[model samples]
Target: MRPIPHPGRPGKLLRLLAEKYPTKEAVMSRLIYLQGQLVLPKGVEHFMSDLHGEYAAFYHILNNCSGVIREKVDYVFGARMSKEEKAEFCTLIYYPKEKIEQMTAARRATPAWYRENIARCLALARLMSWKYPASRLPGLIPARLRPVLVELLATRPEADAAQLAYQQRLLASIVQADAGAEFLEDFASLVKRLAVAEFHFVGDFFDRGGRPDAILDRVMALPEVDIEWGNHDVLWMGAALGSPACIATVVRNSLRYDNVDVLERGYGISLRPLVTFAQHLYPDEAPIRAAERAATILLFKVEGALIERNPDLGMANRRLLHCIDFRNVCAVLPSGRYELRKAYFPTIDEDAVDPYVLTLEEREILDGLVTSFTESPSLRRHVDFLYRKGSLYLVRNGNLLFHGCVPLTEDGAFCEITYDGKKYAGRAWLDFCDQMARAAYLYHEQEALDFMYFLWCGRLSPLSGREVRTFERTFLADKTTWEEPADPYYRLLDDEETCERVLKEFGLSPKKGHIINGHVPVKVKKGESPVKAGGRAIIIDGGFCKAYHEKTGISGFTLISNSRGLRLLAHQKIADVRTALADNGDIESVSETVELATIHTTVGDTDKGRAMQEEITDLYNLLLAYQNGVLKPQA
Candidate 1:
């Protein structure tokens, strides 16, 4: 039947919908389903920040969904299942492929066992996915397996005889098709995905630990995620975009931590050029330590080269080469004149106009490094993912999320800084910086590259809120010079008014939202609090790296936002994942409720809810047009 469009309907959009819906029935069916979904509990989100590589810990936490599996196991089986049984079940959920392989190889699990395990996992997944609408589950499941999974999960308890018979026939078919193990593995993944509806990686997925790319591999596969770029993350980002200053810093750190393989092997970058140049520059090296020191000197030269070319970098303080008294092997630094340690001056030619100038070989090596960073497919792909799913900061579900400070002055005002001849601070400034990051990658512009380096180390940068003190930390004997002053934002973080102002600046309601931050490791053992501003802001970087364990007193933390409320999962330090798993120890976890909702939060209260509401309104209008003869219904 020919129907008239609604008087208020947007023409082009309705036309698009008309082709898909054909008639009002399709749109009405979807609207009815979506409306019902709005009443369901909002899915839980698992938040982790400052991952800093630590692949074992990150991978285990991700696979386990930050102890969500254990909690679910307890909820599903409780005392009925022995501790041993529960532990094995958790293992299956975490390493389904590996566990299945072991069992199959050992002939420990027969076909009957696989069927029983698969059935049990499917049953438990039903409870885990209870919050998500049934329609959504099919999307998480593999297409070929979806029908079997849906049928098994939908089996009614009342129809025991028929359900058992149907289940038996399905199990037989699955076994015959050799899909029993694959089915179990897929079901286990479904449980993990359902348990953690979204992964919010607040920031810092690089440096300080090994195997960051492993986590990156998993993060790319996640259905929903948003990464707030931390200082370290930006450093890598800048390097990946071919910034020599950032590349040098990355090399120095990677060499210092014995993780250059992460850059060379993992990212398919060749550091052999740099090694050859460093060897040529400083010949009489003291073996291993000399290689490290010589490599660091190469980095200094590269960094200095950039600063010399562009004084706008404002890195006069970083001109440490000028302080080098080549003859005496001592430095007259500003803090205090002191002799240098391991004072080697093979590359510093005092007679030269530019001491930071790279040799022909060094330049060649740098060119190679830049090519590796810019041309490698994997490196390009990872950085592209960062651009696609990352932001300087994220404002979601009434909460403000940023990796570092809001960059406040001593008096608790936004510390303004100039960018591209315009002064920027607060939200507008952050947006501008984020835009520059996109421009940096998209256009490969020099100013964008320079800005990316600045974002990595600029003291006034919101991402890097403190003095880097790289030179001082490296060579100076005076501990005083090594002290990098914190931005005034840290002091103001405890002030309610400041928090409110900051929240309002980000266009979030001060009364309704909280600030979630990660940058500095929270010193939980020193009587310091991660929760500040009377719980209006929270810091979740609980020293994910082993390096910070003694200083911050925990391995890491996960901030969970579920239907019930927000909670913090403080994890006990984990030294080894395999040992912990074998012992059924998943980082002794303690959960503390942050703020419980008055009533459990439903999908109706989310940003997604607003989207669904708009869909409902549109569907209703479309239905109205169909009934009122305002628009022609598609045949």
Candidate 2:
């Protein structure tokens, strides 16, 4: 009757209303009112808890609320909430206590991979500590004594009375064997005097020759020494850390040394020392510790500045050094012995030559030169003949030297000339030449063509029969100019200016000291013929790497200086070191075979052993084409 006082009233009203109007609409309206009452109270509770309680209570309340209400409420709450409040809410809802705790514990536990890495690092550190104690005391001992110290420590660890006597004898032998003047004796005296200070090898104390681990042991003995990153060192560290790229680099470097077994065995053994060290030193934070250990190992492999002085040696040893520094597992233990002196090389500023211009043919010719001279036992005796009779000259000073011509006058100093009949000079020529050199080392086919063009033309030119003739003419003309110039030599002027500029840029002064460089071969048949026409630059190349007088050996001149006037040390050669070392199980036959195969393929030749000689011709042609941009890839 009175609308039953609405369906949602008291129980009596509801019964009366149902009797009067039991329609679906009336029932729905009553249900809605009941739902509103339930939700309204719950919503108020959620809001109250979220505002007053910390994040934990807020989240609990949110969870208990109905999904629909919670979503709407969240949006409203977010609008009025402070940043800190919002963050707290997020933390509570997204990260429960249990989950947070689990994550914290998991992070604390070092991963298996990381633990292994730390072990490797510690091994390297130990090696340095044991071998090069002088390294720990920086600025106390001169750089020259540090290497000697490493060698002594490596050979003798116990410091027994007998061992000390043996070390003295050994030092004498080393001094006698060394072609260097009394420098070794001076260095030894210095070491004894400066024994109080720790010596450190900042970089590259090991790798490349043989007995890498042994060398490492010697370096690692140093207590005060630390290491920095070198390109080669980085590679080894990366490889030890299980970096794929580093592994690939290791594999590549192994090819150069022809020591696949050594690579594998050394890598394994090197890792052993590191693992032991990490476990011993950093038992808790193994992974991070392992990384540091690996890094330390790499630091010992840093190549010294001596490498920069000997470009040929640097090229030949790059892969080996890289492997040792980056991928090889050579570990060293330090032994306190003799101190080592650091060797310094004077930097020269020459045009940056293009490596691509160096082609396989050019490299082959250079290698042939080195091989012929070095291989011949008699060549060492006749080195003077090669210089005086063979149109070679030996010129050098204490600090910096070069084999090419120096500028005759300042006017022609920065002038650019075509190197391979190409229409570029200065930086372009240098870049092109460097590129060629790189290609040759990599055994690229086009390296030959580039080489020929560079030799025949003053610059790179298009590859064609007609162009070849033109290039030859230009080359001949240039050569004639070089030979017949009476007043001023162009090349010498360019070289001197370039060198001056480089020294200035590096904050070095030419007047600081002497500089020695060798590239152009000396004339053995001519006596004391001037290598450079008018520049201050000196030439000491002396055809050391080339065949002279049918001799097979590698020859090199030494520069020795003190208070006395600068003098050129006689040229010396070592015969078949590569073959001897490689054959004595230092390098695997299979590795050599693989390298040869790789070289053949890269040079676009399908040949083995005997047929290898024919590839040289093709390499020459390809180099020329590349220089002229006739090669499609321009490589």
Candidate 3:
């Protein structure tokens, strides 16, 4: 048989064929087709003569075939498939020179089958050359599969991309694989490795969101996590107690759906378990028990869904859910009945003042304060030295780190007295300061009662410059009355005096050169401003649990001290405080300027008049829109 002519070039087609089909079977098939030894099987015409296959074989395969075959085949016969028996016999054996000469002359008359077969082989080789592992598939694969492959590879111990993809496809084909379980196990392992200093959960831990029991279970399972009591926790606990009012008022208000019986039953069943958990966690603290009781009551008042949405209510609820103390019980008079009453310091009997109850730290601080007073002559001098100028200053490194601020006397100074040759001044001069501090402490203990009073009435004013003098006169002359009536503005003073006294009593000063006080939330700015007094009094309590500002975020601070200097740190972002308020159904009527002014005057001096004015203006606009039906009331 005449040698086939190369389709394009001998070297190029051979190289193309070698690159396209490295495997023996693929190479042998292409070679046999090029030699014109392959025949289309009967009844497979559709598969064999498809346009795509024809295009691949003619344009791609023959065009890329060896040049020697092209030359020989073209010399013997033109490019065409053979239909005669002679052509089939020619494909089986080599032809002599006489036959080759004759075939070459005949090729000029009729095209040879081997030429077409070589072209088809070259086309097939070209198509196969472009095929990638992914492209070999008939249909388009999803884009997500690549990432899935990568992720699987990352998770496997020794699997690479190829192995991962293979295994993934194999696994996907299997029925009912435990993908979710595997993912959860991996996530749990990751969580175990992460170390967290503290976990501050912001409400919604129970009853509102689904699976409160599950959440509580997870929290209890983790031994190190300490939760700051939230309103929902309190409501659930209260509901368990079977207190109708607590359930109806607090718990009911927080429920998403109106299911009185279900809520009651849920609380009834949940209460014992919750209380048992609390007892296990905090056995020594009675506040936990009180909080549980309070929570049940709150649940009756508020619904879980509403409470979940309002974080402020949750926070306030948590803060107020303290254990029932005897002093709190005494303040209300009747121990069993819950009544709204103004907080006042209970009259402490001499027998109640147990010296043993005082911590060593407290005794030391008290001794220092007394000693400093005994050494100082002038009351003003003593106050300044104790708070501002003493060797152990009351304001530690300008932190204003007193237990509390002194109730300013009428003379614009703290109360002063000379007792046992010791100059006892400031809050220490009057027994009332102690009473006020105790009241504040009680308020801190039972936030709901305190807040209820604040809502209906108003916050007790801190001692002012005038009241300190009145208190001083009363203590000195042993009379409650003064020539000029004590200014009511003095009431706005926070328990700063008491805080100072306590700090002094406890021997806890600003040794590290800054102070963080919790008794009063003093608004401090680095520079003097019309809105705030300039000082180092960093108020951590921005009334987070009690009051909140829509414009500001959660009011908390972290004080980091170093040799470089002290830095006042605030949260990078503010939280939505309004949502919290609305959730608890504690929304209050917007007070007008006049009303705010009245409130301000009652609290302290009228220093906040301008601020109150702006607030009143906003309130007015809000109310006007509400009246005009522009804004709907938020649930």
Candidate 4:
């Protein structure tokens, strides 16, 4: 696999920009354009976290841009359109292709229907395009339809009778030509692009809800996106990098959640070999449980092996396979001896020389699984996407975005973690983890792979602040023994001083910089607020997965940051796509203004804006170089 290239350093980038704009005239023209863009309202950013493979809900939230589209619909149509009419119109924008197909199939898609919708779509696009510059609108529209649509959007159709009639004729021509569906699809794409300038997926795009693979496919199609690696996401990344423990854990999780389809249908990884092996070895257990049990054993074995090889991973305590007494059907732990959930361990022999070592059959099954996970084309594409777009943490637009905690010690300081004979904490540690994760994929080294697995559940891993007691939870009958304590970071989250320290460590303004994270669900039903540290940090995981809904008391949360500052949208349950198309079913999102910008924020105030300023500076230099005869212009 070709390694993904990192962005050039500032000097290198400036050199490249200078080369691109050779002449003084070209440099001046580019500088003027970029400078002009600085004052415009920065596009709205939509933040969602812990999607957990809920594709339908994710798709709807993404299409509707967290109710921003519906709000725009209301703003556009107002009292002229009734409630039902607005709902239908919004539904059309959300699922234009599907709605068009539905109408055509029902024999209700008349030329007049196409003309009306086309007009409405144009109106909505015009409204959305206001947030963006006119120059940017053409790029947002479909290439095939850009020339015609750009002309229509240049002026308001309702400005004069001539303009209105010309627009009407254009709409009619589209309908007459029977290209309304294609036109509407393009319009929908344009509107969606305009509605949200960027999407920040703050982690956990994999596991639980059955279609993380589908979620990734949708995310990949978006124009701009950044992902903060969640623990579950890192597990899959590790698996794709050929970590045997990670692969086993991925499979075990798939089986435990009854999400076998995600493995077999989604990624095309065959579970047949493991299933046949499990069923033959443990015939009395249900097939799924048997497979899960088999995978769990394989997981422990590999984890144990990894721990033994790399004692620095700090997971020696997790090698509990050696503590199990087969005859007694119990495991000795620090607390006490606990009875195993299932005594039938056909593959385990406590009397063996090394209990953590995989048996011949287990080894073959794991080797097959590793091959399947590492070589699956679909899985590779998704993992590549993750690596290309994801990191352990991100600092964007004066805010910090990460999937989990910053790893704080009990004394409210950044937790010091030792890795590769060096101690690192806070941002440095996360950066190291990110590099190792990339190295695991790029070099496929055993140490890097082990570190990647550690990021999934290591105690000090920024992605997973909790100590996962998978062994205890799976085998111990005592519920008391199953408690997995979270790191002190969780306890310190509500402390303003602690949060400020974290912000400062990341080189953000502690006074203005807010930490946005997701991993643990915020239980709203229990009167818990996602906002913590007096609103300096916000945890937006409200549970998109059905399994977490009961615990979180909300379908999901979306954070929107636009010119006006940040607001959070708490969504209720969204109906399936069928209902969305047929009945205009939409997720009802309650919006709360988290921070109202004291002054309207412009593109000049953003990270991108700062980068643009650098380019403008470079252009000025290039112009000087050309004028001084230091560099020649293209003839």
Candidate 5:
């Protein structure tokens, strides 16, 4: 067959391909490999949203792949393994080092026990390999053990007793070589990596919970991960950019939740200065409360100034200082005056020309915090990772993954918002916010820094659907005034037409595409379903934050999209790691299938697959160049 030359084939690009491929045979081999990969089953995807720094719960869920590991153990062993044995085995896989320590302490770390568990882990890894390409497994395993694992996995244990004996010899060799622990760790790691092809953290990986830093460390260690920047995440990002308002708000939230460990120890940020200042400033109140009050006042003052400087933010009503009747200790709202709950404004100069202006003490405290937040190595590392791997939204394999809503009006139209003399709504608004957020980090421009705070709580911010009522909730005695109304997007969640409109706005098909949302917790206790818009939209934030357990009626929700279909796992509360290890306790999850694949999903059907196909085409073009003498192939 005569090779038809592809038009506009740049010589430099073809030459670069030639250097890598070398010869026609090399190009053909790569093409064959890619084509084979195309037919492989799509890797499983685990979608989690609104983790809210619940590290222990996040740890278990992530390690267990939302209980898929246990389910697979059951599928593999069935009646041969008792329920207790399966649980123990699964627990070992989930927490290899801890389980090993437990077993060792109990005098249960027999050579036989190690061999048996290692064999089971290998079996599980082999089962997981069925969904992945042959080449993919080696990268997940340690280099030294890759060859041994591949050999053992190649043997059919069930079909051949001789092969089983061969596997037994390998396991025995590992134990005899004092490599049992190492092999088990690698196997456990391999199995977990294979359990989920990719992890999608839809957002809110900060706040409420005690260990967002630890959570970030775990997430950073994962093989594949993408994040949609949550409101809390952006607040931290803005703080990292040295925005005083954002820094104050972050400190306030840490104090409010009593989760300052993430700041003090995790990020090495000292709250001692603030605590001391608070103690001396408000000597009558308890230490923590005093500090929190100090933070709240600082937050309001800085946020109020930020709002005042930017009239475009449309947050004039949120300026709590101006609205406060300090003498009467009342809030002067648009409706009427309301009594203050605490009436504590010790730092405020009531007689000053501008109440929003920060006092000298407050200014010093905020400057220190901004310096700490921006200069802390750990905080900078984590926030940089957020910038590298996170975005406003991600469209992957036909689904729209975002942290919050597409701002919509009550009438189902995209809410038009004017900012910086430009009108934006829907996709454009999200894009603009994302750009400004990045600019805030990269350049620290005043407008971009201010916009970062706006994105944190602006009524039109896609990340924050509801206006934050921090001031009202903190000081207002009237519970009615504390109610922060949600954007119309929340009200229209169940409307299939609205979902379709949103999908269309993002250039996704309504029939096949889903809007995987976060930010709002799914109130399962109140008979609320995570599935909405007739399966067109799904809210995966079942609230991983322990504080929301009572309100959400579950630990969290995780969406698993694999070769066969899409399913949501509503995870029940996990007591602790001790309970899980000692009692063989697992987070009892209720699974709800959202969509079943019409055909088994393959690598050819995924976004990555499309990119691979383009590479294949380029290779074919290179092959034509070689045949036609347009480009010479290297030997």
Candidate 6:
């Protein structure tokens, strides 16, 4: 892999920048351009969470910028463009390829329409690009269209008619060459890229919805984004790393939701081994009604082994297979003896001692499944992207982003865990777990890989937070056994002191920093507020997964933080993306002001801004070194 050049490259910074900006004019011009960008408004930061494989909705939010684009369009065009025209423009910008094809098919290519819309897109791009540094604008534009875009943006509205005519003629030539549609498509993408400075995924990108792969495609291409790994995301990531426990969970959950298409089609993973194993083990048993009991029994044994291995994980009593009196067709539970919902388990192997162990055929199938998980190129690529750009939690620009809780004890204190003979809690514990997660993929040792299993469901895991009752939920006839306790962190959310302590532990100012997180949905339908800890913390996950839309009663929540203030936007439920687009209906969003700064925030307030300021200081030092004759000044 080659190392890519970024804004700040340490040690040889003077030499590196000297290559491109050898002339003093070039260096000084860039410094001036950057200095100018600093005073201008900060680019907006968009925060989204729990997309959960709803590709179309995710695409809508990314394309429309949660109605930010619409507002900008209204501001830019207003009464100059009619309502109908504004709809068409927004649709084209969001779905350029499809909209262009529709236009070309419906009406023959008209130079006037092409010319006008291209100008509209360029205008929006111009608005988005203003706050960006002038030096970086060229790189953001496509090579073939760069000069025209530059001309369009750089031309003053007060320019002479002759100069304006030249710009018009250039566009006419583009349309005459039949490249208008493709050009606008590229330009539209460029507009979307520049519209938001950074994209943040608060977590849970897989399961419950279709097409996580599509979402990953956009995520991978984004110029800047960060992810906080959600529990479900870790489940899939663990499977991709060949953890058998995770593999079982993924397969079972996918099957439970009838989402096998995600596995067989989206990821191209063959489930033949499992299919054959099921056949071989069950031997064509008649009536799935009777066979489901046997299937459930086998599943219990598998889940039981996982729970029994980690007894102190708070699920030791989840092992219920041994308590089953096969002869009597019942299982004993803490609540009392319960009658089996479905009996007749032919594959129980009652006389055998270790019922928790997988059969020979079952082992072979599991090995094959593990192979498929680890060997699938597509699955590995997406998980690799997650590993590259994600973490358990991130503290950025005075806000803390995490998918799950910090793992608190019953009494509302940090749950300490000993690793390498050292007790770790709070931020240090999270850092240690992150390292262990990475090592789980890099190293082949059983201990390393097994740690992925622990992090996925262990009671003390910040990612898992509570004991997972997989065995109890699948096998128990008692509904009481199905209850998995919520993490204490969930209940302590309104504690300002707790939230402040968390912020301080992460090295953020307790007063200024905020915890912006989501794992559990904010049940707005039930009157649960997302803002907690007396406004020190916020949960933005509002169930982007269609499966939860009914329960959550809203599409999801997004945060937009720009120069002026921080605002929270809530989206209404989406029926269908194609239908919504065809009707020219945007995801109707309502926003509430979370904070309005007395003074607009600037780039200097951001983490990247600090990095840039350091670079500016370094450049000044380089200038000094050149004057002192330690390094020669470039021409």
Model 6, stretches more than 4 Å misplaced?
Answer: 1-34, 279-317, 344-346, 419-421, 575-577, 632-635
Q: Write the per-residue lDDT of candidate 3 for residues 469-527, one digit (tens) a residue.
A: 21122122223322433332233233344334334443444222223333333233332
How big is the positional error of residue 46 in model 2, measured in Å on the Cα after superposition? 82
> Which residue segments of model 3 deviate by more than 4 Å?
1-194, 199-221, 227-239, 242-249, 252-500, 504-635
lDDT of 4 by residue, 455-537 (tens): 99988788998888999998888889888889998888999999999999999999899999999999988999999998899
The superposed Cα distance between candidate 5 and the true structure at residue 182, in angstroms, equals 1.7
Worst 10 residues of 3 by lDDT: 42-51
- Residue range 1-635, candidate 6, lDDT tens digits: 12223333235867776676666666566666556666767778999889989898888888887888888899889999999889878888888888887788889448888999988887788777877877778888778777877777776545788867877887788899898987888888888878788999988898878788888998998888999988888889888998777787777666666566788998987765565555555665533322333335545666677766655344566567777777787877677787776565555677778778777766776788889999999999999999999998998888999988897877778888775468888888889888878887778465556666677777777776877776666655778777888788988989998899888889999887889988788888888888888778888999898888888889999998898888898888542458545766677776878878899888878887777777666566555555555556665
After superposing candidate 2 on the true structure, give the runs of residues whose Cα lies further than 4 Å from its correct spot.
1-133, 136-411, 417-508, 513-515, 529-535, 549-556, 560-567, 572-635
Of candidates 5 and 1, the better by lDDT: 5
Better of 3 and 4 by lDDT: 4
lDDT of 3: 0.29
Candidate with maximal lDDT: 5
Please give each candidate's TM-score.
Answer: 0.94, 0.24, 0.23, 0.96, 0.97, 0.91
User: What tens digits encode model 2's per-residue C-alpha lDDT throughout 209-309?
Assistant: 32333334332443322222122332333333323223333433443333333343533322233344345444554543443433222321222222233
lDDT (Cα, 0-100) at 99 in candidate 5: 90
Clashing pairs in 4: none
The digit string of per-residue lDDT tens for model 1 on 1-635 reads 23234685547776677677768788889887988988999989888999998998888888888888889989888998899888877888788887787777879778887877887797789888789887788898867688888888887755788877887788778878888888988898888888888889888999878788888998999999999998888888888899877777787788777787788778987767666666665677533344566666667887676666656556667768777776776778776687666565676677787778776666776777777887878877888899899999998888899898888889998878764477887888788878988889888787788778778877777788887777767776667777888889988899999999999998899977899989888999998888888889999999998899899888899999988989999888552556644555555777888888999899989989889988777777677777777677877
lDDT of 4: 0.88
Give the alpha carbon lDDT tens digit for every residue of 1-635 in model 5: 23346665557777788889989999999988998999999999999998888998988888888899999999999998999999999899888888998999999999999999988887788888887777777788878778887787787868889977887788899899988887888889889898888999999988999999999999999999999999999999999889988888888889889998989999988888899999988899888889999998888888888898999988888887788888998988888999998766778887877888887887888888888988999999999999999999999999999988899988999999998789998999899889999899889988899888988998878999888888889988788877898999998989999999999899999878999988998999999999998899999989898889999999999999999999999988664688888887887999999999899999999999999998888898899888877777876
> What is candidate 5's TM-score against the reference?
0.97
lDDT for model 5 comes to 0.88
Q: Give the TM-score of candidate 1.
A: 0.94
List lDDT for all candidates, in order: 0.81, 0.29, 0.29, 0.88, 0.88, 0.77
Q: What pairs collide in candidate 1?
A: 3-631, 3-632, 4-629, 4-630, 4-631, 5-630, 5-631
